[model samples]
Target: MRRVALLAVAAPLLLVACSGDSDKGITVRAAQVATVSEIVDAPATVTARAMATVTSPADGRVASLLVKDGEGVNAGTVLAVVDSPSAQQRLAQARQAAAATSTGAVRIPRVNLAGTQAQTDGAAAAAFAQSQAAIAQIPDPAARARAQTQLAASRAQYAATQAQARDAVRQFDAGLAGLGTALRSLTAAQGVQAQAAVAAAQATVAALTLRSPIKGTVQLGGTSAGASGNLSDLLGSLPGGGAGAAGAAGAAGAAGGAGTPAPSAAGGAAGAATPSLITPGALVGQGTAVATIIDVSALGLQADVDETDILLVKPGVRAKVELDAVPGATYEAAVAAVDLSPTTSSRGGVSYHVRLTLGAGRDTAGAVVATPRPGMSAVAHLLVRTARDAVAVRASAVVRVGSRNAVWVVQGGTARQRYVTVGTQGEDLVAILAGVRAGERVVVTGAERVHAGQKL
Candidate 1:
């Protein structure tokens, strides 16, 4: 009887100890009302608002470089001068030809049909008069009769000659008209040729002097081709058309090689040379880029978003950007554009390019921060949705039970599993629409350590 009483007392004490241990082992926090936002994160690259590339207008030796790299310049600034003796000579010749054409001294030989007709008429009259005199000189009685007949025949011959002279005059007039038309045509053609030559020469001369088309910093060098010791040397060394010529080879390869052929390295080299096509002394061909000018007044970010998440991104959406170069700085941004078309990777994954405009940002103390430069690596978090003043809990506190979302609620120092309907889910918090109320203590961490109806 004594042993049984002691056992019952010990069992009650052991039960109390077990309950206290369960409560001590688990962690719980009160659910709170707060705002939650859904965001999509993407890696991004910084770029300038505008970029201008200046290319060589013609094949020539660089005579002088007026601007250095990173030098600020205005539009129409003379950046470099190229010298082509051949081009200069051509221009001079063209100018002379144009001057000659503009003057009226040049004329086609004119035909005088009226003067020729007058000469023909005079000859015909003289022949007829001579024939009449010769007939009068022949006089013997029978011979006189023969002279009279001959005189009649001479008269008839003179009349026929007169008609032939009129026909010759008409033919001469028609020939003269055709000759005038030909001369006019020749004159017009000469004038057109002169004008065209002058225009072409002027263009060539202007191309020899490189000018900046935009107001920005001057980045010296020709596109992808390494700078030569001098412009002449560069031009002489590179193949005609420089690196741009490789494009044709690449195209041919694509057409004949079933798309499996790699692009020519020469083409890539040409592209790299584009920014620095012509140095102070390097030679470059026409249409080859000599420098690139970047406008940095406005900065933007370019990022590739996964195809799955692209649909949620659209213009005008608010975003937050963080630069890799400027740690601890966050810039406010907006989605400026989202590409409708997607780019496919070698692995067959598709991604769309997204552009964002960076706005002014402030530090934790509310002071303005420095603007990021182009080419900076960055990350952006775009806000997709937001829920205001919603009942929410730490994401860890919510657990999936079967098909329903549930949370472990602590009431009377014990955990109770309750099903909750979730709304928008954020990175760290989830909005609750049902089952859980604000200020309710929920098991956030160590929830797996406790079961339903267990002490928390």
Candidate 2:
């Protein structure tokens, strides 16, 4: 029954870890009652906390190289200088424009128009009291009542008239102030635009002195190391590489808009062979790769899980990772976050992105192993669901026949097809909810190829 709940969230793919043995090309194993767990196998990539790439802000030649590749430098350290005359000229022009729009000498006018509604309300009340007093001598009840009602109606009309007048006066005053407000708004807008242009020009000029966005060891002219994110992080977060522990990547990005491109682009820089143009007096273009800083203090993992299985994988779920480069080693990690947006591939398959904090790694003998380098290919086996004491069979025995799952059961030397409802699926075993019973010999391998009523 517990396995039934996992059917909707479990992905069709079986990646559960288990042990199995096959006797022949067509092996049949007796269905046994065992525990099985559903797994969401996702491909993951090692990502750094931050890999800030520094680039030239303008098209100019390198005037000086302050830091060499592979040197440890502090944040805001000047790495290189590009002497761009155009950048300086733009700064001068922006300053002039800003000075022209300064409104210090001109005053912003104030407007106040007192309304007559209050005075009219008081006068109308006094006049109504005088009318009532004048009518009190009419002792005839019916005539007096009619006279009072008439006075009330007249008073109401006078009240409405005064309200209308007040509204008119308000509209007139607003019209008079419209020109003043327009003038103030125009002046403010001009000043804001001028200041923004000046700031941009100043940023460009300052970028000429390329500064290290973070405190880290620099990598000389080599392939621009990609930032600390997997392809999934690149798609989902798109900034600061993938977010990790503190002191990882914050410094790699910017010193409050110093004109350096976001660190994400650093991972897309030139090759390992330092560009010959990086030396002093070499010409370079705008946004040219200058250097990179890799923060090794922290690392993260980005995994892509199929849309069908993502729901079961949540924050804090544990995962065992296997890297292609580090064979026979398993790493421990836990889910940090799951991306709300889905990443659709060209093949039309949709998957949700997940981020995890990388932990330690162990080898086949349970000995500690070295950590994997960033951008390493890895497979994450996320334990999403588990079923215990269920009717289990070899995973290979189950075959998808159109909309249903079935197995080829060998009964008295004859093989027959039996449809079954499955629960949690594992690598070597699958938990069956119904149809095939325990001790039934089912074809584990070649189940898809076998026909019903075939002689075994």
Candidate 2: regions farther than 4 A off: 1-30, 97-196, 220-258, 264-276, 346-348, 365-367, 396-420, 434-456
State the lDDT at 321 in candidate 2.
Answer: 88
Model 1 sits at a Cα RMSD from the real structure of: 26.5
**Residue 251, candidate 1: alpha-carbon lDDT:** 15
Candidate 1 colliding pairs, count:
18
**lDDT of predicted model 1:** 0.58
Instruction: Estimate, for each residue in 1-456, the C-alpha lDDT of model 1 and write its tens digit.
Output: 000000111122222211234445655767767777778888777776665565554456678988888888876777777775544555566567556656753364455644544553453344334333322322112332453454455445545544554455465476633454444334443443444344434444555566665666666753334334355664554334333211111111111000001111110112233335455766655444566565666778887777777887889988888888776778898998888878874357888878888887667777888887666678888886677777777787888889989999878987889999997677677889999987778877766676888855
Model 2: clashing residue pairs? 16-427, 48-228, 69-220, 221-274, 222-271, 222-272, 223-271, 223-272, 226-267
> Candidate 2, residues 263-286: lDDT per residue as tens digits?
442122222334434678755554
Best by TM-score: 2
So what's the TM-score on candidate 2? 0.56
Each model's TM-score, in the order given? 0.54, 0.56
